[model samples]
Target: MPDVLSTWIAQLAAQLGVDPTHVDRTLLLDVARDAAHGVARPAAPLTTFLVGYAAGLRGGGVDAVSSAAAVAQRLAAEQPPKTDDGPSAG
Candidate 1:
């Protein structure tokens, strides 16, 4: 099973049209903020995911998942590289 963070990263990557492996800690936190404000709670992305998950379970729709994933992806893709001349740290 995919870990929650990994899963969220993957989902976010897909949404943002970016690579999952390229998403770093800073970008993750930024996206989490978006989820916090855009979803329900302002602290936990998982809480938002749970809300989405529950809605999906009830309606048999995956829109919420896709939306969350997309948000993650967008956040990752839009991030500026840490260094102007090279890639970021691992």
Candidate 2:
């Protein structure tokens, strides 16, 4: 799975004209996992996208990516778990 994931990331990066070295797959995966488990399953992809966007805005690179992902992971970890009951009307 690691080999396949690495290859896929490389191929996708190449196709997208991005540097494969800029992608820290494990870090990104961890961030996604944290977001999914901490917040909600649907938030995983969106969180990653926002992380990348934030990183890009701050001079994109490994450091930027790491910083953004770290912030996202922290926020995800701090989120309160959702309850099954709907919110009460005001």
Candidate 3:
């Protein structure tokens, strides 16, 4: 992981009063990748942020994370494939 990302995660974990070991980095990254590929590149971070928010609202825990990730994965799977046609020049 990049130094910046590691630092951010550490800071976020500290602010949330949770152990950094509790954060499932792989699962979160997988969700981000799926969201970006299935939806749009810009959707990755936004989707992950929303998922984390949802998890927090439900009471932060492994279950909350799993539930949020599942929802995100489902939404990504349901997104329509991108098309080759570019936006109108106008």
Candidate 4:
């Protein structure tokens, strides 16, 4: 993976009080990519932030991360595609 990403994962893991090994990089990246592509590029970081926040609210752990990721994936799938006259264009 890119050095920046690895650094981010390490930092995030440290902040969350978990080992980097416990972080599911693929799952998190997949969710972020889905949010960026399905929703909007600008939504990527916000979506991941919200997912993490939700996970924390649900009691931080593997299960919480999975639950939050699932919710984000579902929302991404349900998002409408962008259009020339879409709200995103305005």
Candidate 5:
């Protein structure tokens, strides 16, 4: 499952004319992150579709796992600011 995500990233990178070798954690999320644009969670659906599309494009095999891993790593690092970090009532 995770491997599929990576393969999709590779395929997407190729489609976008980005050098796969140059892709890093930040770069992956940069690619995967589509700002709200007046809507929330835009990147989620697109990324999900791309994962499946990439696999279909490559005949149902994992090829972009590394790129997906990079994206996931970037996502974790770029996680939104915590909203629950405040003095707790005890």
Candidate 6:
């Protein structure tokens, strides 16, 4: 990871009153990517938000985050591609 990313995570964690060590950036990034591609671009942030909420309910530990992320990723993987309704009006 770049120093800027490390610095940013540390700063964000501090502001959120979370432990940086338990953040697992790589896993979270993977989950975000899965959500964006498998679901929709907008679903990425929503999925991650839900994962974090679930983890917080589970005590906000590393294991909790990992488990929630895994579930979200699995759901993303199983999601079918979105169907097109039709051409949009300008």
lDDT by residue (tens digit), candidate 1, 50-74: 5445545655234544555555656
Q: Can you tell me which runs of candidate 5 are displaced by over 4 Å?
A: 26-90
Candidate ranking under TM-score, highest first, comes to: 2, 6, 3, 4, 5, 1
Query: Residue 25 deviation, candidate 4, in Å?
Result: 0.8
Query: What does each candidate score in C-alpha RMSD?
Result: 13.2, 3.1, 4.0, 3.0, 12.0, 4.3
After best superposition, candidate 2 residue 48: deviation in angstroms?
Answer: 0.7
TM-score: model 6 vs. ground truth: 0.85
Tens-digit lDDT string for candidate 2 (12-89): 999988999879888999999998888878889999999999999999999999999999999988887655542223
lDDT of each: 0.55, 0.88, 0.86, 0.84, 0.50, 0.87
Residue 36 of model 2: what lDDT?
83
Model 3 has an lDDT value of: 0.86
User: Which regions of candidate 4 deviate over 4 angstroms?
Assistant: 1-4, 84-90
Clash pairs, model 5 backbone:
6-64, 6-65, 6-68, 7-64, 7-65
Flag clash pairs in model 2.
Answer: none
Q: For residues 1-90, what per-residue lDDT tens digits would candidate 6 score against the true structure?
A: 669989999999999998898888899889999988887788889998999999999888988999999999999898876656422232
Better of 1 and 6 by lDDT: 6
> Residue 28 of candidate 3: its Cα lDDT?
95
| Candidate number that wins on lDDT, 1 or 5 | 1
Reference-based TM-score, model 5: 0.29
TM-score of each: 0.28, 0.85, 0.80, 0.78, 0.29, 0.85
- Look at candidate 1 and give me any clashing residue pairs: 11-69, 12-72, 12-73, 15-70, 16-73, 16-74
Candidate 4 lDDT over 39-79, as tens digits, reads 87888899888988898898877899999999999989887
Native-vs-model 6 lDDT? 0.87
After the best TM-score superposition of candidate 1, give how far the Cα of residue 29 lies from its true spot, in angstroms: 17
Off by over 4 Å in 6: 82-90
Q: Which residue pairs in model 3 clash with each other? A: none
